[model samples]
Each structure stands twice: as structure tokens, then as C-alpha cells.
Target: MGDSVTSRALALLGAFDGENRSLCLTELARRAGIPLATAHRLVGELHRWGALAREPGGDYVIGRRIWQLGLLAPVQSGLTQAASPFLHDLYGTTLATVHLAVRDGLEVLYVERLAGHVSVPVVSRVGSRLPMHATGVGKVLLAYAPEEVRLEVLQNLTRITAYTVTQPARLLDQLRRVRAEGYATTGEEMSLGACSVAVPVRNGETVVAALGMVVPDLRRQLPRLVSALQVAAHGISRTLAGPASVEWK
Candidate 1:
């Protein structure tokens, strides 16, 4: 099948990932599946427009302009801005690591986080992508995700830890529970010694994001953590539904 110039250009940019952040021209061409001449010409254009930059060692890296442009995306900008206060309040209240995330394709895309002074160590960061079946936020998002997205994720489940749920049927059951209970919880699913609880943040009838907290253990603070997260999620949903408002009270 023939790809359009736009699709090829996008493929070139999309070839780069968290692990493949930098590539030389030939490597970029091969990875992008574009002819070397076409890649060279298109990459030159992208470099000139600041979508990509040439490193001192001649590798191509994503440019600062791309990051600046990504920050302008409504999901990144408006949602992060609206959710900041609630995340801060949650962090202050529990001193647990608070996370805000949205579904990006079949993955949970971390958009914002507020770390507590003495919270448990977490591996996720803003802009990082985690599996949709292995995290509290991921479960919430998957519970409400489109059927095709859920199926795709179900087929490609990767176990990050021994506690991570890899069975499709089990994950589907958990997703149903997440929807029914209005929250999701995971114990050492994504990382050791880190447990998380998450609730959905809605924009009217649409579940636009997830609000979560990571703690060392859920044995003692599970109830309180869920309560606080639900409250913050409600506030965030209200803000997302109406005009921009930071009053998360």
C-alpha cells in the first residue's frame, strides 16, 4: 500500500519512542520504512521547522519545539491546569504520591503528578506510558475505554511484576468491578512496594481521566485514600465540565 507524504512524515516522527529517542539518518529511514532519499528530504524539512534537531554526534532527536507544542495540547494543558489544585490538596492531605492520567490509545498516559514528601517511590513520570491492565489509573481508564481499545490491550498484556494481571478474563472482571465500584486498586502490580488506588474523573458523562494515589501499602489507609481521591476526582470533573476553574473546594 502506498502511504501519502503526510502519513510518511508522521511515520518518521512516530518511529521515535521512549527507548528509541535518538537515531541516525539511515536508522531513522529504516525504522520509518521510508526510502533513504525521501527520509533525508523530509527530515531536513522537519529539522528546519524545529520538529526534530540534529545532535552534535549527528543523531536526530525530538526538538524542544515539539515538547513546547505538546504542552499546548488541550488534554495536556487544560486538564493538567484544572487538576493541579486537587492533586496538590490530595498530596497535602495524605502525603501520598498523587497521579493524574488519561488513556492514550491502549496505554495509560501520565499527565501530572504531585509527590508527597515521604511517599513511596514510584516509577511513573509525567509523559510516561504504562500498561492499561497493571495500574490503578490504567484499570479505571480501561474500564471506560472503547471496546476495541480494551480488546487490543487485552490481547497484548505484558506482565511488569509478579502481581501484574496478565489474564484477559481476570482483567476484564477487574474492569467490571472498577466500573461498578467507581474505583480501582492495585497491589504491587506495576512496581514492588507500591500500591495504588484510583477513581475516575469525568466530564459530564465522559470519563476523561483518572485520579490516583500511590502508597507503600493499602492495608491501613485504603479507605481514607479512596475517599480523598473520590473527592478530588469530583472536583476535577466539575472543572472539566464547565468553564476553567481552579477552585477545587
Candidate 2:
């Protein structure tokens, strides 16, 4: 009974994600696969414990406590902090939406982001996990990932947009180029109007993260964006390799 209650509570929490940030009681119960009565009881307990909050419209959202706990994560506390300055500098130079991301199993988890003045349609947010095959940062990380992981991801190439790389052979070719050229680029793959370029961030020889930038178009400024991303990525790598790197663990 205790275990069942715990799983149900966890399921309720898991119902919220980058896309589903808020939900009413019925929606939460439906998504969580629990009875409405059970959802109500669990949600009330969670709300009292500060694990969830009710908005003015009465929809439930992840509470401040969840965010506070997320900050304690190594990737969020260390990598994000180490890369914050570099991200800001890159954003200042390119005036483009910049991202710092890490491979989280089969997905790319955005750790930090700097919004640009450019009116590009950016969908990623801090703490959001996006498909690894649809974004520039995802491509870079996937290129460096293990063979089994790559195979698993390749088996499920969900098409995000018309331009997304759904063909395994083509994506494999692109991943090879990323390894050889040391960067990745995408054209309206994840979103319709946005294009992106990314480079790997390493701690010594191991790729630990990816730094990416999004713009309206990459054809005109691909080289410049790649250069800026590489510079920022290298800086982050150096910081992670230094004595301050202990924070990352």
C-alpha cells in the first residue's frame, strides 16, 4: 500500500514536463493514469508539501520546491554555473539564442539558455529535455555518445518537423561529419523558422556538454556562429577541467 501510494505520487509529479507545465485536476488524473479521487488526495498532499502549486486559474504547476531541488543537481549547479559567463558572452557577440546542454540518456537536456534579441522561434527552456536527433546540440552529443545508445536512438527517429532527419543513414552521415568537423548544424529541424549550430564541450578528452546558438538562418553566418560556439565551448571545457571542476561531480 505504501509503495503503491508512492508510485502514484511520483506519477502525478511526472505528469508535468516541458510541454505540460500546468494541468487541472482532471487532466492530471488522466495523464497520471490514476483515479480522480486518488489524484485529488495525492495532489492535496503534494501541494501542502510544496511539491505543487495552484495557479490563479486553479491549474496545478510544479512548485518552487521542485525547482529548488533541481538546483542541487550536479549538472544544474556546476555545469550551468561554469558555463553561464561564456553563454552570456556568446549571446552578446552573436545576438542569437544560446544554449548549454548535456546528453541525458536518449535526449538532450538544456542546462542553461540565453535568449537573444533576434525574433527566432526558440522552443527549448532550462530543464527541458528535447529529442537528440532534432536539435544541433542533440546532434553534437549523439555524435559522441556510445554505440548502443546511438543504435537505440536511431531505432526511434520521431519526426519533429518536415526538415527533421528521420532517415537513420542520413543522420549517421551527419553524425560522422560532426565528429570530423567538430560541430553540428540544423536547418529548421526542430522548429520551422529556427536554424542552429553547436559544438561539443569537453572536460579533458571526454565530451561533457554542447554549446549551441539559434538564428533565423545559418547560411549567411554559419562560419561565424561555429567559431563563436567553439570558442565558448573550449572555455567551458577548460573551466570544467580545472580545480573548480570538483563542483561538477
> Per-residue alpha-carbon lDDT of model 1 for 158-205, expressed as tens digits?
889999999999999999999999999999999999999999999889
At residue 189, give the lDDT of candidate 1. 92
lDDT of each: 0.90, 0.92
Taking the tens digit of each residue's C-alpha lDDT, what string does model 2 give over 1-249?
Answer: 524999999999999977799999999999989999989999999999999999999999999998899888889777888898899899889889899999999999998989955569998988789999999999999999999999999999999899999999999999999999999999999999999999999988999999998889989888888998999988888887778565433
Looking at model 2, the pairs that clash are none
Q: What is the lDDT of residue 175 in candidate 2?
A: 99
TM-score, structure 2 vs. true: 0.87
Q: Clashing residue pairs in candidate 1, if any?
A: none
Positional deviation of residue 93's Cα in model 1 after best superposition, in angstroms: 2.6
Stretches of candidate 2 above 4 Å error? 1-3, 57-59, 245-249
Best model per TM-score? 2
**Global local distance difference test of model 2:** 0.92
lDDT of 2 at 140: 96
